[model samples]
Target: MNTVDEAPRTRRGGRGSRRELRSAIDTTMLPALKRKLPLVEPMDAAQIEQIDRASMDILEDVGVIFRDPQAIADWKSVGADVRDDDRVHLDRGLVRELIKSIPESFTYHARNPANNLPFGNDYSIFVPMTGAPYLRDLEDRRRGPTLDDLASFHKLSHMLPAIHSSAHHIVEPMDHVVAHRHLRITYSSMKHSDKTFMGMTTSPKNAEDVMDMCAILFGDEFMETHAVVTGNCNGNSPLVWDETMLGALRAFCRRNQPILCSPFVLGGANTPASTAASVAQLNAEALSALAYTQVVRKGCPAIYGHYLSTVSMRSGAPMAGTPEISLMNFMIGQMARYYGVPWRTSNTLGGAKTFDAQAGYESASTMMAVLMAGANYVWHSAGWNEAGMHCSMAKFVVDAEQCAMGYRMAEGVKWGDFNEALAAVRDIGPGGHYLGHPHTQANFQEAFFMPELFDNNSIEQWIADGSQEITERALKHVNRLLASYEEPKLDDAVDEALCDYIARREREIPAVDALNNEH
Candidate 1:
């Protein structure tokens, strides 16, 4: 929690340094376009004012459904109108109070200072949620995720530079005790990277138990550096806050910890079978969370959590990383801005098959959409596919490169006081290329460029190089990176402390083998 710790030292020399090798295999990726794409563009100022007014009206009149009696009573004590034991009517006055308490931003510590990332208003960072897929291992080609697979995925995620944090126990690993010991396991992995947060279990009590363990790991100054015990909250239908979610919210507020209040609004499910309705649902859930923040502690630091997915009408399965999902993230980013909250959304994904066009197209499209939409922080930006059912280490490396490409795109055209560059452009005039200019050589790295994840080589060279497809290339790249990865150095004292914590927790929560055993 001490924000004053020294930053992590920068790593010396990696693949990133060899960015410009002019082979067709190395053509830099290019951003598709540069323009704001909004759900409702050019809504007049009056219309904008109307939406805000109407939203407030809904907060007060239509009210939000609160499934927790305690949250309702708490709101009632604060003078909010209570409709029932569970639903609380929140008005603009209450909303404003909550918004005031939330902080503009909060910092997440890195073991090494360089890895630390600040989340709030002006800064955004992305960390992927790993697990759920590999229903069968590709090696044994087994079905469902096993403990070893999950741990491997965790380590793979640990190596990503762009993915700033890793969600512990991505799926139910074999070490079920460690499942609850996520704080310790996460802290261990976190020794390698600075920003570590957790995916609090659906059960609020379980979430709290894990957080209590983390608090010990962090000592007294916990909130300042850790990702905090931020849980996911999903609405059943028509988008309403449930008891489980409210409990987590109240706990965080009471403890003065930040909450990642995310609502997974499936397009065509729990929402008006339309993308716009899904957007409305997201906005409503966010506002409700914002209102809760003000009520708990006026202006308490809260993150804008928007998770979007689509249900296939035919298969009844959730489809993530679709273009529609990315669009959903983009619109949600705007909603986050409207409320002046920092946003957390996920990036596009590869697929059930790690190395293929399906993965490439999906990841690329989603990344471009979210970046342009101005999403500050992206979760699950790399790895996992087939509706979060599996993860690919190879894909993780490829996605890292993709994320870098998107970040480069986001950092577009920085114009400065240097009239020299513009004047030089004028001097070079029509038909004059900058390829030969001294300034061009000096600053091309600063300009737009792509990546070499695929074989940018000419057909002849590609054929000569074994006709390796993107997937094959990505696999090789991932293994090479993993081979060179060095385990992070942690103080012996801290490591032992974490070990004791996990052992104590295991004694408390015995493993249940027969529970929820579906593959």
Candidate 2:
């Protein structure tokens, strides 16, 4: 074979060029990772077909509950069987036909043009964890999170390179009332970070309010055309979609913005104990909601989403990093690909109360499965612990660095300066090493992936360095990130508009003392 050498993407250009490249890539928002490695297909064609058939049979026969009058009306309009006024039997053909209009790929627009996320076709977006009710402070004490804590998480997500989105509701603003919390969280996400952010889905009005603020920031016409924000609606698992979630779905769909139709699955508690059976049921629930998005607005963007966890047989506790979890990840990825829609999966999850070895192993396992399964939107990719009960500030930074390392691995190996490397090997004899070679000097900076948090020095050096453990080290990094954070630029008029809207809404929606049920 006669062929010339191929230059790697990061061409060797000596010191000045390498420094320039470093400057460009070190601080800026990392784009959606374009994976070069092949996806891990854990199932054969026949196995996938088995899942597909089971899902279709569930939808056509068992039916999914659409617990809203409008959702039932929409289903009837789409020729679905609505007998019980809530549960609708969807035809598999109809779902397949409606979802065909979904765009296979779409750009997730951000306030800064450079941060727009590219979705689908082996592109993965790493997002921070959301919906954590408690916060594990830098002192390793658990407490209810406040608005300031929420803003801090947004700033960290912005400073981190691998995190793609400034995910809203990183933790619940327990200081704020439930009725008005969404406004503050959404505003903090927009102001603290210029990256794409998720929208509030607590209620229909809350979702509309987020869109209104986005209209101010991105312009009404621009907001109409581009997906500047995203909203996530989780189906109450075991084939149920509540009115609150459906309301948010319609609100987002009407604006032509992308919405994630996810089913929150806890195996054996909310679903069957079997992994394949739960995957089939979750797939059917997700497909019904995905099809509903098209019914709300044809051609609107949608994602097949789910939260997968297995329950313990002893106490019914949800387990993380189980073999069944990875299996579901693979099967769901396969189904999403077959249906031509983007998909989402959880990452960096653990059931440990502390960031110990259990947390590390669990998070590592989930992260590996997420990347290998080709999840398009990786939620809970960082800061998740205690089975999502709390967001740890220490684990947050470590997880971000972990995401950066994972991203590098997902990029596949680079062959920069192969011929030069071969020449260096030849110059260094069998008895000699290449540490002092010219190629080594030129490429050492870009050669290996250097992790920032983990300590790798010798015991003597480690002792001299103050004998710091991982949690303490991670705490230091968290403070450093917060101090280094720079708030992104926003138009003054737009900021004023967002504040005005929040003020008006707060006045309209009163803060109640306590709640027994929905008012």
Candidate 3:
């Protein structure tokens, strides 16, 4: 995980020049390998079809409650069976038909063109932990997050090669008013990182404000031609779409921005107890929101998001990185592929309260599941702890190193030019070492994935280095990154315009009650 001091400049030239193409290729990092299909299928085709049918039955018989009047009218206009002014029963055929309009893959543009991400089959992008209200450091101390903490996380995400995007609301800034926090967070992300970022989805006005700020940065016409941001819209489980999320969904969809239409399910609570029944409900909720994206504007990009995790029936505590959740990830991947739409899941999810061994194992297991399942858009890929209640800087660095390993593994085996290796083997036959072989020297840089945060020193070196644990080393790494943090240069005019927009919006929108209550 080598950190570049500055982002590489986008290559200039049309797609014709061979030298320019080579330069472009040299500048871009290695892409995640395309994973083979059906890495782990927990259900057979018949079972999947049965679950699909069950979901369709639920949609038709029980129907989902759409709290927004406009959403209800939109569904009614689309031939859905709307009743009681809120519930809408979507035909399975209509869901399938609307799904057809979604592109299998599309380019998500960034302010820096070189950082654009492609979402589709076999491509996985990792984003940092998001929506956490608390912050933890290597000292094992926890406190409410602030804008400064948020900016630090953004800078770390920008510095890490494994982190593909800086997610919105990386941590809730308790210091700022809820009405004005979104603007400050967005401004920090835009100012600190050049990569793609998510949009604020707390409310429709917040969503609009995010878009207006993006327009100030990337221009309205450029936004029309390219999707520079994405937003997550969640469905209230037990088959309900709340007005707040629907408003955000409409804002993103109508503007052609990508949305993650996710069902945030805690099994045995919001959904049924069984995994199969829970998955069916998840599919139904996700499909309803996805279809609504199309209804807003056909051909809009959307992802089938699954944040399914089972809660402890005894204590009713939410769990993460469980077997049930892993199975759900695999099943959701299969369904996303079947529908020919992109999919998203999480990484580094855990229930552990601290950055301890439990956190390590849980995060690793979940991340491996997402990678194996071929999730295209992964959020919470690093730093999540206490079942997403806190974000840890140490854990973020550790998970990032693990993510680099996952990227290398996704590459599978590369059997390039075996002649040199064979010659070396022949030369070093029978108990001889090939440590000094020519091939080893030539390919060492690309031969292995080097981790930046993990401690691999010998015992003597470790003792000499103060016997620092991984957490301590991680804290040092975080400090080093922030110390060397270089803000990506935005145009002076654009910066001024963004500041003006934020000030103007702050005045227009009165301060509201605190939105983030999870302390």
Cα deviation at 229, candidate 3, in Å, is 0.5
Candidate 3 overall lDDT versus native: 0.83
**Clash count for each candidate, listed in order shown:** 38, 0, 0
Tens digit per residue, CA lDDT, model 2, 115-193: 9888887899999999999999867889988899999999889888999988999999887778888899999999999
Regions of candidate 1 where Cα sits further than 4 Å from its true position: 1-44, 131-143, 146-148, 171-188, 222-230, 320-327, 350-355, 415-450, 514-519
Which residue runs does candidate 2 get wrong by more than 4 Å? 1-25, 514-519
Position 121, candidate 3: lDDT: 83
Give all candidate RMSDs, comma-separated: 7.4, 7.8, 6.2
Give the Cα RMSD of candidate 1: 7.4
Local distance difference test scores for all models: 0.61, 0.88, 0.83
Query: Which one wins by TM-score: 2 or 3?
Result: 2
Candidate 2 has its poorest 10 consecutive residues by lDDT at: 1-10
Order the candidates by lDDT, highest first — what do you get? 2, 3, 1
- Candidates sorted by TM-score, descending order? 2, 3, 1
lDDT of 3 at 364: 87
Candidate 3 pairs with clashing backbones: none
lDDT of 1 by residue, 1-519 (tens): 111111111113445532221121222222212323333233345644555666666667777787777767768887888775666667776676567656666676545555556666545466665545353332323365555556555555666555666666555454344345454445544454334656455556666665665665565466543455455555554547788777767656655566777777768866668665567656666778767766766645677776677888998777756767765665666666666777777776655454566767777777777776666667777765666766655566677777766665565556662675776788789988888777777777766565657567799988888887665666555444444445566667876776776677666765655436523
Return the number of clashes found in candidate 3.
Answer: 0
Q: What is the per-residue lDDT of model 3 for residues 39-153, given as tens digits with 9 covering 90 to 100?
A: 7777789988888899889888889999999898899888999988899999999998998999899887778777877778878888888999898954557998889899989
